[model samples]
Target: MTRSQTTLAADAELTGVAFFTGGDVRVRFRPAPAGTGVLFVRTDLPGEPSVPATIEYALELHRRTGVRRGEAEVQLTEHVLAALAGLRIDNCRVEIDGPELPGLDGSALGFAEALRSTGVRELDAPRKTLRVHRWVRAADGDAEIVARPAEGHGPAAAGLRLEYHLDCGPERPVPPQNFRCEITPERFLEEIAPARTFITADEIPALRAAGYGERVDAADLLVFEPDGTVRGNAPRFPNEPARHKLLDMIGDLALLGCDLHAAVASRKGGHALNRDLCRTLRAAATRGDAPITEAIGVSTDPAAA
Candidate 1:
């Protein structure tokens, strides 16, 4: 089956305080033509410079994913990207009046909900897809991500599947956790999008000293205390940290600018490792070393059941 490219049918907007800057930010999602991909336009800046949300523009930020186009930069983009990618929105123009996206609820649920309300429109163009044909891996100490070809055919075998293993060490607040899921709009919204970003209680002071998350409170996100308890919130899932890891991977992998068909596993991975996997897969696909498929459409299998 062929899959057509998709974009928002109408405009959608969200507003909140940025996680890093602690300033008000408004993001507007506008529909774009097929093949346009995702572009972030700095509406607040002079001339409104735009940055393509592709691996080529990806920047290694502290504990977050970012992209830059010369002097124009957007920080903490993973949640928004994850929302768009999870919904399979192929083309969009994301206009924002701030350097960073709003950190609403520290999850992608808000963005996903807003985009869903706008509905999606299919385009005349076919969707671009990349299928992993060989093993590819990226590692940083104990943190790593690996991708390999999917087995079988049809939609179920041609979509991305992710598994995450999170272990913050025996002395850390967050305990060992695991999560696995095949990427789908429904599953993403319910199982992954609501998983909020979290931090260890001890890391707060250093983050503050580095001028980040000043306006953020425990209620705005998850902060695990040393006693292995959330400071001011409850876990949406028993293994929400692992699910959030998968959420971050979905966003970081979206930088590929195409649908991915692979079985990817991560162990204690973060933005840096996720981006590294994207870079590796992208390089392989660009070199014609990996199998490239187009418009495989949605999966029809009940593997996620």
Candidate 2:
């Protein structure tokens, strides 16, 4: 739902020992003036150039998602992105000295807890929203994501319906997985954010060879084992994979450059659909386009449910 701009309370400044999963790293976030959006500055980079979390700067989405500006980029950014979007904490500087955000417990709890402990303050400034005026949609293959403003702010939600047609590996025991939930920050911390990320049994050899999650052991990520082969870490829920997909979708969609104001449902989607939809809408917006005025997946009979 669309919270009034005043509901944000105020701009905030957050500071604490930065942890990169392995342990505490050095970093901090100070509130920028309203409209600054979220910016990441890598102190570890030469002269510490900054990266703005905008669709124009999105680099790629593969085994995981990363945002970049030319050769300089950040990897596996979904966790932090999830935390920011879920918490509704807008406008802060993410200063770090690494290529990846600390994957604390494969969840957003660390970031949430740290920010909570630091406490939030009210800044004497106003917030801005990139309100949708018309509809724009995009798709890749069979997966799709769409956005349309409701008559009014009803509920703030980021949802997904992901279907894995095949298991990730020979040892994989899990069948097709899926789930639907409202996108609320409170729901995130208590019900969703704590869920650990998982990889399939079949992906292990390749992920390791690719130099991703190299420091992690099997336990750190869910590796499914069927029979003698191992599966992902034990799932907190029966359909943990799809839930994590929802988490990643919410995280990725946060880059849309605005706090959402409608119910968004995604079907069998991933970072590919997530980023594609944003780029499409953003381009339309650059040309003064608006949200889709025409109907799409919705039906003409509104009362039928």
Give residue 51's lDDT in candidate 1 (0 to 100): 89
User: Under the 3 Å rule for N, CA and C atoms, how many clashes does model 2 have?
Assistant: 21
Model 2 segments more than 4 A misplaced:
1-26, 70-72, 124-126, 130-136, 149-172, 227-233, 291-305
lDDT, candidate 2, 17-98, per-residue tens: 2223243345565555555566777888787877777666776767557778654576666777777777766666777777
Q: Global lDDT of each model?
A: 0.88, 0.58
Q: What is the lDDT of candidate 2?
A: 0.58
Show how many residue pairs clash in every candidate, following the order shown: 1, 21
Model 1 lDDT tens row, 114-206: 999999999999887877777889998878899977777776687899999999898998999999999999999999999999898999999
**In model 1, which regions exceed 4 Å deviation?**
291-305
Backbone-clash count (model 1): 1
